[model samples]
Target: MWGLVAAGLFALTGYLAGSAVGHLGLMGHPLALRTTHCWTTGPSTTSRGGSTGGDWDCTGLAASGGRTHRITATGFTSYPVSMPVRVAQEPWGSWVPVDQGGWNKAGRALSPLVPLALAVTFARWTLISYRGWRNSRRLPTGSSE
Candidate 1:
């Protein structure tokens, strides 16, 4: 019973954490999300921790507050060229432009599974315990006494 409750807590925490990380532009490089400001091109974007998750080479221009910022991100094959991207600027000045397909939003996509898996595990535990108790309560099929 306590295990189930603990799992529920863990699930909620994980989901919330994932959401926060994702929203904070720390999805690609959560472990090494560098905030140190540096120059990549004409003092436009942050230089460090640009692609800590992988060798992401996607580059594009983001319009934030009417100012265009050059950005390199670890998401999407081809960024949307028509609509204005909901860009997330990291503290280091990295720009993460949101795409339509959601390939980059891994945390938002995967976080809820933590709670789901926990719930399933607890459900299995309960089922097994109930079965064990039921079987224990059963007497011998053909008792002579």
Candidate 2:
């Protein structure tokens, strides 16, 4: 049951992420602009208690009007890491003023999807944890004597 739940959740997350990617691309949004890329950085290790070893960072960049704006998300500590995004837009030329509004709007719109994905992931993990607890309670506490 746990496995099934996990698989279902994984599928759902994938679908959501993919949908966001596709939508941003087609909508000519921040995620669709030229030079958009996401990079994650952190040590890859897990503790015995299921805790992560280091901080994780997710950074995305998009360029418009001869300038680049960076959107970054970060996570740390245990599960369900919170990744608040930050945007830094560089001023280049006269085109910068005209493009700023659209870029800012796009960035703001795309921002919520991050938390949505995280919420879905957390729900899935919660389901798995609940199933484990249920199963453990059903099992006998001691060997037959």
Q: Which candidate is the best by lDDT?
A: 1
> How many clashes (backbone N, Cα, C below 3 Å) per candidate?
0, 0
Q: Which stretches of candidate 1 lie over 4 Å from their true place?
A: 6-104, 140-145
- lDDT (Cα, 0-100) at 127 in candidate 1: 81
lDDT of 2: 0.44
Model 2 alpha-carbon drift over 4 Å, by segment: 1-100, 143-145
lDDT of 1 by residue, 5-58 (tens): 757766685655555454555555322222222223222234763542222334
Candidate 2, residues 82-116: lDDT per residue as tens digits? 23222222221101101124674476446556655
- Which residue pairs clash in candidate 2? none
Residue pairs with backbone overlap in model 1: none
